[model samples]
Target: MVPQLYCDFLQPDTTARHTFTVKPTELAYINEHLHHLNHHISNLIELRSALLHRSNQLTSPTYIVPHEVLSHIFNQANQMEWRSPQQAIVLSAVSRQWRQVALGTSKLWERVICQGPLKLYRDSSLLIQHCASYASSLDIRLLEQGYKLGAADKTFDTTTTVLSSSDVKGKLKALELQRIPSPQWIHMLPSFLRLESLSIISGHHPSVDLSSLPLSHVYLNGSTFDSLILPPSVLVLHLDDYFLDYAVILLRKCPRLIEFSSETYILTRAQLPPNLSNPLALNSLEKLVWYPAQWFMELASATGLNIPVINNLELKDSEGLKPAPFALLCHQISASLESLTLTYFSANDDWSIADLRHLFTFPIPTLRKLSLTDWSHRLILNAICALTPDEGEDGYTDRCLPKLEYLSISSQDEIFGLEFDFDYRVLNLVKRRRIGEDSPFHLDFSFCSDDDADYEAQAAWQPELLHELKEFVANRPVTITIKGGEVELDQLSTARFDDGDCSS
Candidate 1:
């Protein structure tokens, strides 16, 4: 129809030799019709484009997916650290259907990570407000600005504006503040009434008090506080590079704490309060992880601090393990400790085999599971010797950890080393333990090596050892597993012993 109307305007010029004169009013009339024709053509082109887009969307596989499934995918993507806020924004811009799903998924907006110059705090606050409107709970992270330029007055003002907002204070459930520059920011923490988990890393302040809030988990790393207080509602507490004296003070206040972990806590025994002489009891504590500092060893070994019923204990020391203190500490908790893991990364000469033997000599009758990681093969052998039953005048008797049923030994550098004696001893211990027990016994060994020569050396002896182990446990109530080096036993049958297992 448009082409036909345009052809009508050209009809008067069809004769080639005809001379014609047009009046200004007649020319104006022709110009008006041509302008209208161009406008209608543009409208028809836009309509065609719209229809094509809609057709593509209807046939696309992504558009066919249910909104609930897409929303869940968006939520999972939002959980990733790298994807986070950018991923959520990108998802909302992909298409109409995706934007609707992304906006409706509240979890995608729950985590708001704010990190930039002080000038952006207002923007971050606005983002928090917008997110709070859609999410009932918020996990906010205020990361360090990385530059201290012009941060003195502006830091406090901007941080307060962002953190003290009614939406932030009311909706925040988890808060992580990293390298907070000003002490005033610490004072604003108590205003977050709905906060349950808080992590403050790498800052120095005179004091910190969270007793007013109903916190269930708190993590403090590379931070110093003169006076620290925790509420009894705290269930998990982790302190790294903090003062041991302060940790002791905080532990005394948290009676309901179920899990406590301390790593590299500065030891200042002289600064300890006089009342610390009284036995500190954590009756409800279930798990204790201590990366032992010297003061931690002395405090636990010398003092009367008692954890009556700790079920899981993990002690990892990279320097070296002191035998006397470790033995005493184990004996103190031996009654109720059900699982024990010992990890050390010291040079072979720094610790002696006798030390390892002495540490395990204490009878932890209640301990059913034991794991030793990154220890020298010699030390592991001594540990096995200590746990093995000693020959008495009458018969095999006086075995340490009489109720032990599970043992796992993992070494990243060292293997059994050109020696068959360790293999025989391990087999002997397994056979003796499984003899009169109706319950199944589990033994796992993992030896990994970065050096090709070392791995090959380990490979040479691993097969024979695995074969002997399989034969001993064949058709018996015993489970033996081996991994790392050149071993690949995972598929051979939960029963095959010809080759070792590889787990990497």
Candidate 2:
């Protein structure tokens, strides 16, 4: 279908040594042909789009749905919960009417979560255009892509402008920047007053200097931040893989801090800093979470800090942690701490069952909620029996933690095995606690497994436990929850729980 002149122009010449050496006249002819082809394609596309729109209007249930209903449906279809943008694009591509509706729905554009780097970098310009309108409180999650100069610079620059925009300044609520190459990215972030949460996850060393940013919650993971200079505006701070000196210094800065969480190996055999000999109490701090049980010992030795008001304490880490530090910690904060969560990475450590029993001997009178994950039945029995003292033929002594209301016990079903009467132990605790109290006590006995290979086995056991549990709480004001390996630990059931509440 080619003309003689066009065929001659298009054919590759073997005699020519250089490439793409077309004359000006030939280039102009090629351009003209391309223009005509592009126009023809555009006209065909418009015609096809119009036809599809008319067909959908007549045949689709989507056409019958009201705008408000459609908008709501689109909102759900758009993965706003995960802050995804692809679904919105699919919705917009359905037809002309759908495209208008999707673009008009401002909530769909609220989140820009680009998981892959190269795709995000290549499509940066178009993606911004799609999300720019009605993005009052935008949440942008950029994953590290290839480090190609052109794409990287363009992507970073575009994002910088977006973050610095007037609308974004007032409405941006949370920003998660993971593996973004430049630490200058932190400086490029203008002071976002509305920003409540910020997570900077990087593997490389981060040179972060927290200025007067109104950040209520800040989480830094896998960073080599040896020192910290935090603003007074911070309330809740979580630092993973940080030095003890840095944590102490940061805590000194945030006087009104409420909750603090950190994970570090420095505490395994950590020594106290020279300036931390004297006591420094944070009366306002209510929650203390530390990983690698050794950190608890380090924190105890961290005499500079006296977290008097700390009630919720969570200790997590691998095996081989001694109990002396835990005992010392409990003795220090036993008067104030009400909720205690202990989790072990591996179930190999003995953890001194006797040491665990000795813990209840201390005066943790205010303790109410206790969670033991991946612990043996002996430990569970020890924890429960610790509350109620066993007297011989004489009489029963006053129980420990008489005000205790909630108990949560979780472990791998495989580890617990079929030998233990987990149900009976929990029932005994419930009966003992519900003796005369007007209020009911809550007991959560949950079993976890690796996969669905044992789901059937776990399900079979649940009914029997549930049946027995019902009999025990028949007339008593006691709530016993016998859960199998079904309840996911991380997923939140409702909006009342924040991202921090769900994060590991």
Candidate 3:
């Protein structure tokens, strides 16, 4: 649409005019043309809006990424060490595409952990419902962080109702409760059909029965021996303070138990039934552990149960204890045992050091691994050195462990009352072990001292010994490791090797 003045003055034969008179007819014509241009501008704006919407859809990375790859990305993001469920919630809220991918992936919503108070049970229930249908197995943990154990005002009924409801029951596979006040309502813990592992960590005994659950692993951190009534389906049981009789009852009931561990209390020898004379055979038991080194002596004397096929044994204590009973224990189970660990928790007068040397009295041919933690001394080092083949006119006779392969000794205690060295005696043992052929033995030795120079001397032993041992065997199979800390060792014990220092 041309302006009226241009149309009138700029004809082919007409002269150009700079001024024109205003007329009502030309004014209406100009208004009509302006309305048409306004419509064209509006149409161009609508076209741009439509085209940008199409461009966003075409350029979005979500459209480029295949659904299979996006699902894996969501799973990887959720696989990080999640301290709380809020982390997963934050990932889902990143964008609409992220929320869709997170919801579609079942593994992302499989585990839900809620800490602090029963009030969060409702929140957890909602989360469980959201993930219930797709998740094949659900793991939930409700922790009462600040509540006092056995407090009268605390109630876990709300938590029980939410967990026991139909929405969250059959799908629960793992549940961990930390510091819940009263778990008496946990009798229904067995009703979760697919539940595999349950851990209740508190300071009070809730008198809850777990005998109906087919749980593979159960850890009752604070329950007493009398209150524990385990089911037959339990494959592993770890208790805090258990009695001799309760241990017996548990062994008799759970024949499928693979491992049993506890912090045992010392009880009387008379607790054993007078009519029972023979040792009960624990055919399926593989590992037995007792803390407070004296408990091993007390229980061995009290209950004469024989673990015919046990593989691993560990004992820890602080008080000075005799090794005779421990030797007898090794004699009973030495045929099938593979690993033994003896730990002393104190650094007093080295009274337990003498007892540690007596452990080699009973020969364990099948013993493969031995750990002596916080009990490292000159006497114990002699025991290990004694394993070197005694090259006489006849062959070696005092070979204590024929098949032994691994030995670990760590000394983290202060050296005020204890003293030892990282000198030639230990170095010679490795050289002698490699005299005939490649020996399969490996020693892990760590010492703590105040001298950094001592560490340099100690650390040099490994590479020096390795260089010499490889002279015979093309590839030396023996490994000797040495490290040092803040404890002091004068390294003067080599001169006393001829003093007949075997402390029997």
Candidate 4:
């Protein structure tokens, strides 16, 4: 299909070394393969063009009626009331074609959820059946009562033996099960055939062997994965405290894994993974993420990942991090980091303004984009001033973040010189604290989010904030992202700040 494929046919194999160079059989075989591939390629191009044309034709807004129709559907889906989600499911049931379209579209059917015990279990089964063929990604969440059902059926659900028989279980490419009431339902999950990404939260554990699971990417949060075992096929893994043995098991069993993030635990105790005995390190690794851990620094020191330049390392719960070692790493990170994010953990009581200055002591000569959230903006500003090109300090006239251009901050106050002459730019900022505490503290962490459900009620979603944001959008191109609760922005050229108390 490619030039390389053609070239590969020309290359001599081991047989070519020992005998008469080119055999007619080899030539014929290669020719047949090439001819077959060419047919496939021609078909592929035609298919692609057809799909593009169809997509354009269908996506164009033809009528306001359709928009009005879809708006009510989405409104029902997004509603906070009890039957809202079920109502979303019911809307799809208006007709077989509608059901097919709604379930086949990955975004619409991605989240297969129902709260409490819906009388529509029969209808839910139909959705599961519909998704079996169409779903590329799946998120199955049960309401509290649904959780009870999962708990009641725990033993029956978490089994490979049962999953193989289930129709909806096989087509799950990326599967997420959230708020599972019981740990027993895991057995009923389908075995991994095409499954690549799997996330299980607050669910029951599986009892059977998962060696056949085709999982390549995994994320386990807020539940126990102590019983879950990933096959060596896993390439990327994410874990929360619910699963502790993930890191240790992967280190020992998963030789091909390249990316890993786990908040389970960072310790070198008796429970330390068997791989730690003489932990073999990965050489093929390119990216690593470790967030909000009590022993993050110690784990960093223990792993061989202290490579001179880590591609992009994030420090979440930065409040837990001590100043000295973090400063040391920041200096080293300057050598190779392309992007860095420092998210403040809620536990930080003594988080200081001085820590930012420490980064200035050593030039982050290679740093390009720096994001800081929840801390004092003045501290970061002071650091910029250090890199500031004063007449006597540097050979140039003005250079703050000489190589650094984009910055995202989430603090209450405004810090200046961000646009000071060096191609530097402010990307965005967001809120760090809850709304009940203070209004402007919401100005922090605008550049990012990971799901702020821990304090949704505390989030500032007031009509006023939305009104101001809408006004800003009217003036300039803007992106307003709300994840669970927190809101963030991209560029705030005209953001107004109210002077408010921001006590630690």
Candidate 5:
């Protein structure tokens, strides 16, 4: 509504009679200008008040993100390398109102990580305090930051003896540490009170043994084998290359081991136990694995129990070199097997597709995940392709994969063979041309011994032929993992290249 004075003074014909210094016309003009200025200021004030009111409504009340989302964010924070602190920074800068909300929320600040820029992990007990009663899994990785291992024996710079320091109270499920002090360190492990899964990562440190630890499930690095005195009642034991010698210990001690794996380890003749009173060790064991194949023994001794509950068997390229022995070993595996893999254990026998097929003949009725590596992919996929006809009229696809969920094949060993190639036979693949001649290829798939670039270089190699050999993968229905870690042993699996997707 217009003010009465505004309407009266704005009329040109009317005048401010109270003004004696000027005429009524001049007074009318001055009054009009003042009225217009007042109207504009009032409009601006009303707009500012409205904006302020709406902002207050937003700042008030509990602004909560769902717990499921918060939990997911926490999980990401726990696993993130460079993203956690950035997230905290972004939240802090949203606004003063939001800053208060974020600062007051102790749950968001509780992810205590070690080795971060802030170095909250130096004193775990203090970090744990911030978590209070809501602490979840605690993952502590021992790093090679300062200490170094002796060439022969394992040593620790700091002996975690007070032992009270490592002790953790709560439902601790996972404990990850690197460059652990020694076998005794695992015995004195602080989180052992109630740990469900434990990983000992010894990056460049000597291997330490853990045969005697009471953990239910154990994952070990190859260098962690400084020494191990396994507990007889152990259930699940995973040994990397470091524990290849300890396989005998596993056989003797962990009778109840349901699952076991190694990176690349050798069951050398040197470590082969003198088939003593316990001629058959690991009798109660179930799942068995040796990845990045080294060498396979025929295991021809008609002794040892039929791995009863064992379902997964990963045969790496190394398995191909010792084909006869490995094949014979598979015959003794559990009849209820669900997955079978023939991966590039290492460069042995040039890892031929045809050779692998010759070994794996018996059908595993319960097999679901069938995987292979290098030419083994062609071998396994060819078998699956044969088993599953292009048309569904045959029972190949129908009865073949009734229980199967995943099938993966990797080709990481194209440059190298599955098993160890003696200095010469490797040249045969390099010289051989692709089955088809009219193919245009650019990269050479030939294996050569370059001495310093240190590889064995191919002298007269065809580029097209090599590319075909390197990238020739058939799209099969099964989930495939064509690439895997490098570890050569009897099993050489770091080679899940053919193993089902463990990432999910």
Candidate 6:
């Protein structure tokens, strides 16, 4: 379909045997046609690119999701996984559409976490500014670089400047500051009107006055309480690695506390507050978690601090707890207590079977759930044995925790030197508890061991015990789980139960 002049122009030199001359006008015409063709080809290429883009948009899975729904998904992701401004940047970099959605989603920029060196915080100022622009309320976390940086550091000044900014200060709701050497920034706390939750984990023991703020939840770790002032509005308080005396001081101040946890209280020889003729009652208190120590017992006895409505109690590191004090504390709160968790108890000479029995001798009829974790085999066995009902001369009667509906026990070490009779005892306890109960009874036991010999021994007896228990509770409202040495008997029973075979 080519014209003669055009073909001659397109031919290679090797194909041209004779000299063929043409008019300059004909050559210009050929050039003009080639330019038109080139322009048409450019347009076709552009058309192809547009079609491919359109096809990709139609086939992409995320393309079907509306912009608002996609933004909500990003918001949730930002809350759960990405609690930093960097998350916003990474999300915006995914695609053009995602960038638009992420930048537009105000909730996605609500929480900004800045950790590492001062330089990092300085560099992230623009991101923080962007976050502050989009979000009405913000939760910010600023973790200091490992070393001590003084108030004189330029980075610290930059941080203070950003936080003192009109937009960030008014919208801040929750703030967590960790390991910053200078407590000078504590002066800015009262300026944050919207701040409700504050966590300060520093050894500086800054004198903080929170009485003017409307804080509801406060967590202080490795911080002193000598000069700290708490507001009456606080609902939940967590004091970690603090002196018992300091905790008592704080507790005495917060009358409306609903939940209070104090971990690893440092025992002090200094006497606590003198015993009041009338008990300092926390009638509003519902939950109490603390390390069981002699000082706490003495303090409770001396001050007569009453948590009459306390329903949940957890005692951590109760390995060597004395009997009389433990029993006394339990008896005081036994009337309303519903759940009890005892953790980190190991084998100790002082923690004998009789001690545990003595502690539980007082009836906690209101108790419904009990959990024991990281306890020695002997202690766990004794605790369960104490709970197991003995065949009295009259009839079978429940001993302790008679109304318990849930029991969970776990140990990380091997049940060394204990017989398989332990498992039998557990089975007996389950059978006795679930006999005529219409309510569901749940028992979970985990005694995983890393030793090969222990694993083999457990493997040998676990299947037989699991089969017996499964067959017995086949049609009852009882759920029993036993996990030994890396293997979960619950899964095995479930598989067999699904297959309609309870005997295997």
Q: Judged by lDDT, which candidate is best? A: 6
Model 3 vs. true fold: TM? 0.66
**What TM-score would you give candidate 4 relative to the actual structure?**
0.56
What TM-score, over all chains together, does every model reach?
Answer: 0.71, 0.66, 0.66, 0.56, 0.51, 0.73
Residues 1-504, candidate 1, lDDT per residue (tens digit)? 112222222234323453447677566766776776677777677767666656655654345866445444544343344445644433545767555544655665677777655455434555666677777788887776622423456545654676677877888999988887667777888788888999988867777678899999999899777777778899999988866667778888898889999887454332454566678778889998887634557566445777888989887764544666667788888889999988864445344556665666577778888888766666666666656655541113545566777788755544344552555666666655553355677777654443454232332334566576667667767665564333343333232233233443
Per-residue lDDT of model 3, residues 74-98, tens digit only: 3334333433444332454576644
- Assess candidate 5 and give its lDDT: 0.44
lDDT, model 3: 0.57
Clashes of each: 4, 1, 6, 22, 59, 0
Q: What are the per-model C-alpha RMSD values against the true structure?
A: 12.1, 17.4, 13.8, 16.8, 14.5, 12.6
Q: Candidate 5 on 227-260: residue-level lDDT in tens?
A: 4555555678776665334565554566777777
Which regions of candidate 1 fall more than 4 Å away from where they truly are? Answer: 1-105, 115-123, 144-159, 265-275, 318-325, 345-363, 390-399, 412-422, 435-437, 448-459, 462-464, 477-479, 482-487, 490-504
Cα-based lDDT at residue 83, candidate 6: 48
The TM-score measured for candidate 5 stands at: 0.51
Question: Considering lDDT, where higher is better, how would the candidates rank from best to worst?
Answer: 6, 1, 2, 3, 4, 5
Worst 10 residues of 4 by lDDT: 427-436
- The regions of model 2 sitting more than 4 angstroms off are 1-109, 129-133, 144-153, 165-171, 190-194, 226-228, 264-274, 318-325, 345-354, 391-397, 413-437, 446-472, 483-504
lDDT of 2: 0.61
lDDT of 1 at 100: 51
Worst 10 residues of 1 by lDDT: 1-10
lDDT of 4: 0.48
